[model samples]
Target: MSTQPEHGADKRRSTSAMAPRNLARLCLTYALAGLAGYLATLIGMPLPWMLGPFFFLTAASVLGYISPIVPMGRELGQVAIGLAVGMRFTPAVLLATATLVPHMLVSTLYVIAYTFVAALLIKPLARIDSVSAFFATAAGGVADMASVSKEYGGDPGSVAIVHAMRVALVVAVVPFLVFFLGDHGTAPASTEVGATNYLSLIIALGLAYLVAVALKPTPLPNPWLVGPILTGMVLGVSEILVVQVPSFLIIVAQIMLGTWLGSQFKRSLLVRLPRVTISAMVAASFMIVCAGMGAFVLSYFGQMPYATSFLALAPAAVTEMVLTAKVMNLDAEIVTAFHVMRIAVVSSTVLLVFKLYMRMKGSEIGPGIQ
Candidate 1:
């Protein structure tokens, strides 16, 4: 009848053996992230909540000041961003976005094609295998590409690093580039950030989280984000629940995303493969330039702003790009739509491309891939 020992064991298990230490680390990480976000805002930085924490933590992680990480931060951020963006899809906005489907499709293909070329560039520059290079160069989600690379016998670590470097470069550069171009004026936001209805927000987030849980067994790429977005779109378009996520919440989400992203920077990875990292940086930079060119073409044809077009076409760094669009007063809905479409197309076709290319090579999967 004595349950003291059993309860004590349960208490220990709940601690996770180092709960205090882990909690302290997490608190410190978040403190740094919060300070960085605030400082960014004070300094008039573009996408400050994201870029500030991202750059700050990135340097900290690299320089051994801290190894920043936030568990479940990415998913939480995605949900918040997804809901925020989903509210932008008014009937008029949706109608306008629909008109540019063809242009977006072309841009998506252009991105994929250029990424292939980037992969080719990586091969010689980094001396990495084809599978790793290809997956790394592709502009899909980093985790998604890395997983596929593993399946295709690619170096997942390399894929992750290259993708990380590419993401960091694009995020660090694109917003500033657009800012310097004078396109980042105080443009209209997607939705008005009205007085947040705390009750409504809690309900909405709860539903979105439930939706994510339900969709977890499915093949959705980013259910946490996608689920909330879809839900928000329905509610927004219907005008049934016109609630706003507090600015603080959105900033918190950005901090979460930035923290997780910054933590992905492995100093060891860079040290171990300096040439490969450099090659990835080069390829990423090249892709960014190509995206700029594509933006001009798309802007001309689509009759959209050059900045909007550019963000829509930018490779990798989807959330950051979309956030940039929002911050710059660009067409965030269009940007979000374009990124979603590209992810869908890439997720569906990338594996097929790799498989077919392997078949075309005949007999073997290529030493680069192997």
Candidate 2:
């Protein structure tokens, strides 16, 4: 009896225990990321907090420094970003933004079709399997796509790399292009930042975290990010929320997000499959071109600045795109709405879209994922 109790106790403790070496490695990884962010600031880089850490960490990881990763780093960053973006949604802005939903939906369909063509390229370009190509080219979150890939007999590793490469490329390139092509501060926030209400911000964060936890089991993508945005929108639109997310927190959030994204780069994976990596670069460029074309449509439809439309339709993570919009003084609300709609559509319909694409190819390659 005594032995059985000791074994059970040990098992419970073992599950939660962290080795000291692992903890040290984690600390070291963050230190490197922070140092990179600081250096980026010194050079006056665009979106320096994110881009700096992203490039440095990516290079370090690829150079075999370590298998870099940050636990819950992205989620924490998203919570802050979601809250900050949500506070931008005053009643008039939210209502006015709703009218553009139809155009956004059209763009979503265009993106789905774009990914379909991109996946086809993977076959001839990379000589990879169809199953892997299908998942690799999805515009949904990298983690979400990679996680479900294995269920469909897909190469999760390849999918992860492709998506990460695409995101990293978009986040890196789009801002510079947007800045160089035109002036700055053309599309500032529709609503001004109200007085800092730390109490309301804290309470809203706690509430958003709770709602995010509740939505986790649902099919809602990026619940932590979506939760705070929704909470902020409802509160702000209803005249309850009255504070901006602290600038310091937003900067830290950017650093965390940038570091996490940079950590996703696996040099070993890229080195092992150079052709796939090359294909990823081509696909990313194709997507960027497609986004630029879509930007014209959005700019015309919404009568907004081209830069705002470009970021709105940019093929990147919602948080990253919205943060870019905020940094450039573009219309963050429009960017947020477009990404929210795109992600919602992609997350819900991605599998169905894949099936349709397979049918179009006249190759019933994969059955429905369970």
RMSD of each: 6.9, 6.3
lDDT of each: 0.78, 0.76
Instruction: Write down the TM-score of every candidate.
Output: 0.88, 0.88
Query: What clash pairs does model 2 have?
Result: none
Give the total clashing residue pairs for model 2. Answer: 0
Span of 10 residues, lowest total lDDT, candidate 1: 1-10
Model 2 RMSD to the real structure?
Answer: 6.3
The regions of model 2 sitting more than 4 angstroms off are: 1-28, 67-70, 186-195
- Checking candidate 1 for backbone clashes, the offending pairs are 129-368, 130-368
| Residue 118 CA displacement from its true place in model 2, Å | 1.1
lDDT of 2 by residue, 1-370 (tens): 0101122333342333245656667667777777887888898778888888888877876787653344456777888888777877866787778888888899888888888888988767878777778888888876677766776777777777788778888988998788786646653343354466788878888877787888899887678888888888887777775567777888888888887667556677788878888898899889889889988988898787898888877886788888888777777888888887888999888888877777777875565543
Best-performing candidate as measured by lDDT: 1
Model 1 lDDT tens row, 25-45? 767877988899899989888
